[model samples]
Target: MIQTLPLALPGALVDTHRIDLSALYSTGWGVEAHDVAVAPNGEVYALYGVHRYTHGVADDEADPATANLGYRIITRYAADGEVLASAVCCPSDGDGDDSAVVNGGEMTLCVLPDGTLAISARPDCTTLVAPDLGQVLAAYDSNDRRPFEKFTPGDAFASSISVTPSGRLLCVTTEYGVWKYGNTLANVVGVADGPLTPASKPVIEAIASLDPAPTRYGEDDRRDHVRYQGDPVGFDHRPRPALTERLAGEDRLAGWRDSRLGRPVPLADDLFVLPVYGRTFRGGSRGRPFVFALVDDQGAMTGRLGGMDAWDDSPFTGFCFNVASDPHRGRAFHLNRYGLYAWDSSGTLRARLGTDTKTFKPLSRFTLATCSPAGELLLVHTTQHLVLRVPTPDDLADLAPAVEQALRTYARQRTALKSRWSPVNWHWTHTTTVHHL
Candidate 1:
């Protein structure tokens, strides 16, 4: 059952419904949705993909067509849970070729400050397609059938995309480096040869030069200096042994490891980059993945900075599928298995919110999160229901007393459990003896 909890004001609450999507579509069809965003007018849009899944049947069951194909779906919804628009972003089987897999549509969409929508798409296996402002918006409104500009020379996977305040669009993928689109998408699309610029070079050398090299010395090496305690050469100093040689081997190993790890690189004026460990299923492990730093335009990297770890080593950490700037706090917020972690404008971690474990509790397990233009929080929870107009700072503060009372109740329960099960208590021992009989 779905539950609704009221939050304190300046907050508006809305009820959510879990539509049984499986029944809405035909069998053998699969759907997965991601990259949800809310517009200034509170309209929500999401990118989804449809595929084929095989289900087992009994001997008596009727035979059915088993071939599976894939396509993409784009859906838009009003604030009041009304379906405003729906379109097939990519028609996978349009060519009627069974051997070829058709992957279409945009993986990432960004709404510019001027109310224009930008989509990053890979129309085929070997090209990157991004339509300009005029083209993108026209496609969104279904005014144009073709809106993508293809970069022919270089192939890229459209994994992620973002638009800067100045109107530059950055398209990125895990396998390929980043590409920049100028003020208009036309400039990049017109050049069919390849990326307008070459892939960014790794800045390993600059980071290595920032530190000084250590001097080498032997364990028995010693030095003596004349000391003038009262007068010139009045006091003589004994030779002191140098400690550098003793730690030379360890220091050299450490330096080598540090060098191999590489240093963080700056993507934009505020954004920085680092390499994070990624997941591996086989016995062998893959190299570390890249982590991008998200920062605000006015923020300085010297202080405020928040980072995204591609594959975090910490057991508590999980994959971050989406990240966005919170308009209310001016911080970058990301969704992870451990909940939402907030980072300042310069890409530094500010705070981590929500429960430690995944649960159906309110304000936890956010699959998709976005801050609307009006500064409201919209979350598509793990339950697959859209939650709109959640509480903000003032609303949380207003409910502080009630929230504290609930926490106190939880604390008391924990204390009672400890008292009942503690090894120091004799009752537990007595109970155990009775059970043995």
Candidate 2:
């Protein structure tokens, strides 16, 4: 049987800028990935890590934090592919220790409104660096021996981070906990006092489906130790130490899941164009389940909006959602290993740019990135680490309320997307929470 796959007309996107992140990846004495970690904040795109510099110290002298090897760096670039600034992210631990600092563990990072950088790899370890990547601003650990909170190291692995419209820091861990920070540990106030549920309080009525819907990924992944307890998705997954102490009902295992979001990028003020926050257990299958969703001003899950075809199979190998920033109101782009798919607000494929046939482009990584209102916009940073902004595409404004409303409607009205799965066969219900903020 022959299938006609669609070809992506270049009109869907233009070659923007490519920057060489080699110098940034070089540890001078350690190692780094061939790929660069990029965060979009409107006009400039910041890539995590910086050049390997051996200027001040001898080859034998190593930074105390980086396993006593290389320097941790972060750099920001202007739209024209010019170097905005570069600074050490994981600096040497003071006291003349011969190792890299324990903050901002590795490749994971987020850019704050004030242009500050938050990077973390290990659980509960966060390092805040100045925008220029110049100096360390603040650092935090959940299980710090000095401050000793009741929290575990598991509570600090922030896989995702975003700032709400209100100058508050929002972070989510893979297993458990969602945290918001301002001055002190503000987890008890405002949005911090949340798993911000929907205000409308939609009525939820559980009913059996004419056709049984597919079960969630795993028993342990979604269910409690007994494998049948409570609604992991419906209820709040935040830490309840008392619940853990009791070791009794549904909250027995606490909260744990696979992928936290599709890709951690902001879609709008109170919205994000991302994938599902849950994942399959080790013994089950792996599916790339993505979704569009809304959040309250304080940043909490409001509802599940929709997109993508998970009917029969998954079309993505490697992918990224265009999480927007300031300066440019970039549209939402779904970049699979094959190419890019742009969607209209009405839950339909609008345009595509790239190859119809997979494996056509020999690119390891492709970010639906935007910066520089420059014509020569496409920037390519090669293995050689040359920072150059090549050229760009017109920033499309797509992610709107209408788009989410359409998807939300679709997820509700239709049992399956593109008739790939039967909705009537699935047992589903709406879950609600009290509005915190």
Candidate 3:
């Protein structure tokens, strides 16, 4: 049921497709990418699908928990059509054996200003692989290094993540409105500019807290690690997000048990752009309009950016992926099933790309898009196992933050041990950490 809706355009957008995925696409395999990002040198990278387990064992739940493995395959394509890097993801069976898995889906990803990829992977409850429940936020840096850190949010299902210019992380999760995390992934109540207060004081106490500490993980948590039969693993793939069960008579709160937010972007000194998605049937659903909101460093609502209904078309159901913001251009870009949309920092609509049916044929539940500085829009239609390109708006800023080249600085740490003088015969050991030079 693909419907073509008439869309207004500048006559500059020319859509084309590429089918040679170099084995990234095949029959019976599903693909998903929140956005396919283009690098400064024209390299394109994305978090794509890989078979759950090649060998060992299979459970009814394994079929659905593909994304839980983290960025199983960080696929990189050269501007000239070649596979650049084949980075590994997380694990599947007890044996490091993954020829393939059936019925896996797509994933959401964003690149840091320094070229690190941050992914939010929610385990599928239907395919109960492990009983222990939690969500994994994995980071992969530019050099194709292993996941440096896996931040587990005990109660929140992270939907999308973005990094600020100063190196802090920002994201939108299921239960909470929006959150900011430092490089260490610690939840912060404020930014460098000022202290942030909760929009609702009462709601602050009401919401379940972010996991004080990440779930314990071993060094081999990467997806490509070896496994075997009877290896220790969780059988429950079901999600166990903290639910807001009952609210005391606040109609403004409505029935929102968990607010499903889109990508959070830190735009200026204190202003940040937050894309608020409609949470129906647990988010990533269809025909729901996106409400754009603005907040200051204090996490207070400064104003409403308005809904993404500038065209006044149907409700936007497909979630926005790799949402790009151009502070220099004073605008941002969002791609969903409805089409590619350009809006100002104030959430004002500048243009509409197309509709779900008119854009391209979708094979999976999600679609991904990113822009090129050379007046090209590089997109990956995961469902169709294809790469696409279109002309960019003449005035659109190359605010492809993820794609820009950044001179990176890696932090080094020094560890030391301290011993407390024994009072009688008992000695206390303490570990001290020194950061930076």
Candidate 4:
């Protein structure tokens, strides 16, 4: 089966701007950009997770007092890509240990209508931070306990947040459904309900069905040292399948899984687009996932794109589809390795722009991204420590060449990244102290 790219419709998205945040990542031991958002005014905000490892002691065994020490970093950048302000907030000291003193690692960000940054840093609460990074303006706690607090998976937890046109905050969960809260962060106004599909269940069971072949992958499996307290155990066979079988199962699931939303993109005050975030299964699994769904103000699905399908399977990051809407043009954009796809408000394909360049061996997959009113697409590549800006053009002819040029520009920017920096000084200057409420 030959993979075919999405048909180009009428409009195009061109790459024009780029920002490299590798400097900040180099400053910490295990710093990562968890999320990124672009404000209407062209300002960029990023959620950074700074990992601190106490080798001998686990996260729970570590001191709770220092749990919030250097964990969550939020940086604001100007339209020109200069670091404007950066702050440190929220605790990041939990790893599903029931006895863990602090459980506050997960976080996501979005800018509110009033020009304030809204952050769902903890599972139970969301905060409104002043643009100047001076203070936490207000906070809304759902008064609910997250599964992570109890060290177990449950119905759903906040995975990402966005602002609706009506000045309400939209919270997308890891599963279950999406929530709508007032801009004041006061109360839950509504919810769009849907349970997550057990998309990986079939693949998981196939892998589990394999016969136990000791030393197939490795001899001394690490389960004994990690799970059994060094007790000599039998052959570790659970979920241990042949490499070919595992790959085949994984590929099949990727192509045909039910739709899952990554983050909702508001195209207007009354319209939003939800990207179906997942990868394509290889081995001729012809199923094609829906690209995105258009929703009304009431969170009702109006239309969706299920026509496009890629020819080849390429590995993507945490979220396969990163979506953002250019409300000014009434268009929604979906980004992946295959291309950048655009759809009109009515869910019609408007354009398909490529991001391929020979300068980079493989194009970096951005984990988080957002669009500005001025038609700029801001992308955050966590592993690459890159914050990129690209211009969204309306014509494919213009976009095709611009894509190549912009990618080349990004290549140059990525190449200039230094290997290391002073963690202490970077934290002191770039991270503001926020009280853990």
Best by lDDT: 4
Worst 10 residues of 1 by lDDT: 6-15
Model 4: which residue pairs collide? 3-311, 14-393, 16-391, 17-389, 87-432
Report the lDDT of model 4 for residue 291.
Answer: 40
Instruction: Tell how far residue 3 is off in model 1, in angstroms.
Output: 13
Superposing all C-alpha atoms, what RMSD in Å does each candidate have to the true structure? 20.9, 17.7, 19.9, 15.5
> What lDDT would candidate 1 get against the real structure?
0.33
Per-prediction TM-score to the true structure, in the order listed = 0.47, 0.47, 0.48, 0.59
> In candidate 2, what are the lDDT values of residues 1-437, reduced to their tens digit?
00101111111111111112222334353223222333444334333332234455554554323223333444455433334544433334234233233443324555654566666554435556555555565554433321224423322323335444454444443322222111111111111212211121111111110001112212222212101123332123322321112212322232322223333333344444334322344563325343544333333444433344542223334323333232133334454444445443332444444444433242223333322222212222223222223222343333232232332443343332224322121211111111100
Which digits, one per residue and each the tens of the lDDT, describe model 4 over residues 260-353?
Answer: 3345666776676655433344543234434455655453556775446644422142234567777767777666665666677777776655
Which of candidates 2 and 3 is the stronger one according to lDDT? 3
Q: Quote model 3's TM-score.
A: 0.48
Q: What ranges in model 4 sit over 4 Å off?
A: 1-29, 58-70, 94-106, 121-124, 144-160, 164-259, 276-291, 298-300, 310-318, 354-362, 413-437
List the global CA lDDT of all models: 0.33, 0.33, 0.35, 0.45
213: Cα error in model 1, Å: 25
Q: After superposing candidate 3, which stretches have Cα over 4 Å from the reference?
A: 1-29, 52-71, 79-81, 94-108, 116-160, 164-168, 171-255, 282-289, 310-322, 356-366, 371-377, 389-391, 394-437
lDDT of 4 at 265: 68
Q: How many clashes show up in model 3? A: 31
Candidate 4 residue-wise lDDT at 398: 60
